[model samples]
Target: MESKTGTTRRDLLRAAGLGLTFPLLSACGGLAGGGNSSKNQAKSALKIGFVSPRTGAAAGFGEPDAYVLDLAKKSLTSLTVNGTEYAVQILDRDSQSNPQRSAQVANDLINSDQVDLMLTTSTPETVNPVSDACEAAGVPCVSTVVPWEAWYFGRGAKPDQKDAYKFTYHFCFGVDQFHNMYTHEWPQVPTNKKVGVMWPNDSDGNAIRAALGPLLKQSGYTIVDPGAYTDGTNDFSAQIAKFKAEDCQIFNAFPIPPDFATFWRQAAQQGYVPKIAQIAKTGLFPSQVEALGDIGIGIAGGAYWTPTFPYKSSLTGVDSKALGDGYQATGKQWNQQLGPSLALFDVAAAVLKAAGNPKDKLGVANAMKTLSVDTPIGKLEWGKGPNANVVATPILGGQWIKSTDPKYKVDFVLVENSSDPNVPVAAKLQEYKP
Candidate 1:
């Protein structure tokens, strides 16, 4: 590691960061480091294991990964710890958006590759299993994108569990963020306050349904929940018919990319379009909107990252605009995953340096338990978050619309930011006309 650069390229000599992997070592490796043995491992190149969904349904979140990894490769070529410099290698893997694969890759990184630290992200499917693998293996891990509640409780961790998941920490929005962003963003359009929610049977769906549904009800809106549907179900006729029959004027959902697309297209075909189709988990990217052709124009969703955010990546010292511009240079529209995905390594680099020795797993985990690094998304600190092992990052409300800009076919305009007013609003809300 070099003080000037701070990190180096992690190789695939074995396998992945997510457009979300947000690093590794094993049981007999850095976990019990000290004296000459510790020094020996510290002198070796620091290996980081990154996991994400690059080839599956959640691929939208992985779109900016290559660009982010490229920047990390250039900026992370060297790392400095306790005045000692060591080479860095980042090994990234693809979850295929499957939780089982996520666990397998994480185990491979920890037990096989002997990664020093671990970072994974995107959704619970990718984040939870990878985090769980690290937790069981005693490897320090960090992640983002999924709601904090989903990552925490969904992992069978209780609020009073006392020091739950010491090896794994998380940073992302929670139910309260949805209560704020949705309550503030939805009222922009005149409605009867009737919301149709389609929560799935997965981790994200279960968490949202348990917390967010009640909040919307307390806010004086009538929630019509169609119960939990299994993921990858191509038919949503029953759910659509219920919404249409109830005359629900607003809609909400937390589903994977393909599931949402299938349900949404089915809803439209069945004549069940809502005025404010506030969505989560999906519809946060430009290509997602482009997939629906014109139907995606006014559909609303939450943004975990965007170019308008007035922040910068700590590793490359590139702000939101610079990051966005760099991706646009690649001829791809900017994505919300760009900031957080890159931020994962930003925190990883900081954690490695703060660990005093890159090879010490306990030191790395302890550092992750407290280290707060300024990232492209915002300030991500562990203890400062909602729980000891969680950082409640900001989530803003936005909508997809036609883009006059030559580079993009559709533009994601920020319409509400009450969750974090520091994030400036770009445009007013537009009602989705069926």
Candidate 2:
């Protein structure tokens, strides 16, 4: 729950219920009574609010956030707009990995702190709610980490719709990108094409079930879905039995971290190991896999970002390896969320600077629509994507390998890069030997 500003989001919640809501209201209320001069002087610095799930079930996404935020603040401390030097103030808030809390903090950022721009990350749990708040409040927002379809259609935007939400823009891979990765990697493992799926009755799971399921089925694969289970479910014995009975040798799931850990352990104990456990959502981070011990080896997952990616940060010009090295140097583990998290700031800086007026929310949001900038995850082109406000990043396919390498406990090696060939393949896809 720690933040780069020396204060945690939990501290704000404790000091004032719902993240300084009452106090912020009172303070802003008093500010409204001030003369025009005082109000104008308040615009001396540009305020940006960054929200993420720093705690709860998805806390791993925020482990290196504090460090990244500190780096962002140092590099983007000041910028000139219209010949005026403006100091930048970034207020970080924790979503607690809950949708309600995500919206509440975003509201406070837009209305209370008067942030000109908003940035949110992690998953649908945090991104959807924060995007809702920003879109409703007419604040320019940029988000990453979540799938594009989950963030777009999960919020009720229909397929092929352009500019469905004008104020909010998202940059990440969608189900199509995942489909490409899965189809490319699954064949290498040599399965019976009967894939077992765990589709929870949630945004990410549902979206994958509806979209990815059909894609696989169209490609002549038999899908064995055990109905939709809820997140945080403890027992997966029934689901394992169904997959075992069907003799399904390939498994895939887009679930939260803890649920995957629980189900995988149960599946192993039940002797229902699949040839390729092409899991998503979870298994992107090292700690999640390390928790599974030897069972974690050869577990295939989609890679959104990796240290070996051939890209550099637009803000700092630090390449993928350098960024990962700097993070590992902090005595912390390397994660896939690092590149996209930093890309959020890179896009923020470009959007605000291109706006010509940093204080004008509408101007900045408009600039983001046509903006294309080179990020750590490669070039994010808003105009070239399926949606006007959505820029699809590459979704590489990789597997977690249990290694004796001194640097990593479980190393993720790239296997497929159909979306972006610039990302090199580090290893060939291997069958799970469980």
Candidate 3:
């Protein structure tokens, strides 16, 4: 893995195209064990571990994680809780999106690197072992992309099975959110009621299917024949033909961004536009929007946060604008999908602030359980039900309306807001027409 030296505060602002005059670099004295420091003060050099695949197939996801972590570290120093000062040090680990490598890297972070906390993107194949390592070490892990069920139910073993790993927490809404959007929301479209699903035959796809398959039948929806496909089989023409044969009305896709784009182009070329299509994840990133061009229009999808939604102005006395602005200044776009990286930072910040000291993992864990920090996405509360880490955050359903601006190719129409946990799944279904 390639590593770079840490940047100074000034360098970060310059990279973000912002002007900075604050003497933040010199303000480190308080954090560096200077005057009036207590003898038992927590170690000043606070280190947080960041593990992501910065070099493999998921580099698109991993690179942004690293960039966003750097951005958050730079800005979070200005944050304080009850007059306590803290500094963030990031240790980068390249998991390369492999399970064994992810486990090894996670073990290193917990055992040798002495990371106060761990931040990671969860893949079903990779996250389980890493979660086990963290659980064993008593480390608090805040995963940006791990699905809610992985943290809630524990993936490898049955929900009732013993020896289940339970140290990690999911910071983002996972397949359950997707299932809610599809089973509950997509049915609302009166014209295009039929559902067609095309997913990769991998662990990620299986997890999604496991959650949605049973629900689809229970919801009285038609499951088109020849549903799922394995990875590396580029041609989706056969599957498109099946959808055409089934007269599928609403096309639902869960493939990765590149495969999703290819499937979309193939479907378009085959004259198979299913009144409207609802896609998840990869389809919502800015890169997908730019790559697919006009072919990407009219597609509806769910997202955690968007620049479009309104959030609380005050978040427990923290400036929400500063957080949002810091994120926007980084120049990363999420198609319509809100990057979970920012949410992960908020989770970390919440734990850090509540703990008052950076070195306490148990304190961080307890703080996370009760955290209700407001973010640009809205007010977030960790689910206090059976599941601990899964929070009831807002998921927005947006349309890819034709762009009015020549420079920008597409814009979003906020069709409906699915923020409320009490909002009936049936009602969300009724409102979310593709």
Q: What is the descending TM-score order?
A: 2, 1, 3
Instruction: Put down candidate 3 lDDT per residue, 1-434, tens digits, no spaces.
Output: 21143446567567446543233322333234442354334455566777776655454566456446665666665446566555667787888767788889999988888888887764554555666678788998777564555544545556554323345666556665666656545645664456778866775666667777667767777766475687556799998898898888877766656578778888888988776688765655555666787777677776665554455323222243444454556664333223455566666777777877657788776666767766555566765533565564556566666567565566655555554443222122222222
Task: Supply candidate 2's per-residue lDDT for 262.
Answer: 94
**lDDT for position 389 in model 1:** 88
Winner by TM-score:
2
lDDT of 1 by residue, 1-434 (tens): 32223332353222134431122232223234434565676567888999999988999889989999999989998887777778899999999999999999999999999898888989999999999999999999988889989899999988677468878988889999889999899889899999998899988899988888888899999999888999989999999999999999999989888988898888888888799988888898888889988788899989888888898988889999999989999988888899999999999999988888778888888888779898999888777777788888889999888999976789988999987788889988888974
After best superposition, candidate 3 residue 244: deviation in angstroms? 1.6
**Highest lDDT scorer:** 2
CA lDDT of every candidate? 0.86, 0.88, 0.62
Model 2 misplaced regions, further than 4 Å: 1-37
Q: Between candidates 2 and 3, which one is better according to TM-score?
A: 2
lDDT of 3: 0.62
Candidate 1 regions exceeding 4 Å error are 1-42
Q: List the pairs of residues colliding in candidate 2.
A: none
Cα displacement (angstroms), candidate 2, residue 257, comes to 1.0
Q: Comparing 1 and 2 by lDDT, which wins?
A: 2
Collision pairs in model 3: 184-429, 185-429, 285-335, 286-335
Q: How close is candidate 2 to the true structure, as a TM-score?
A: 0.91
lDDT of 2 at 272: 91
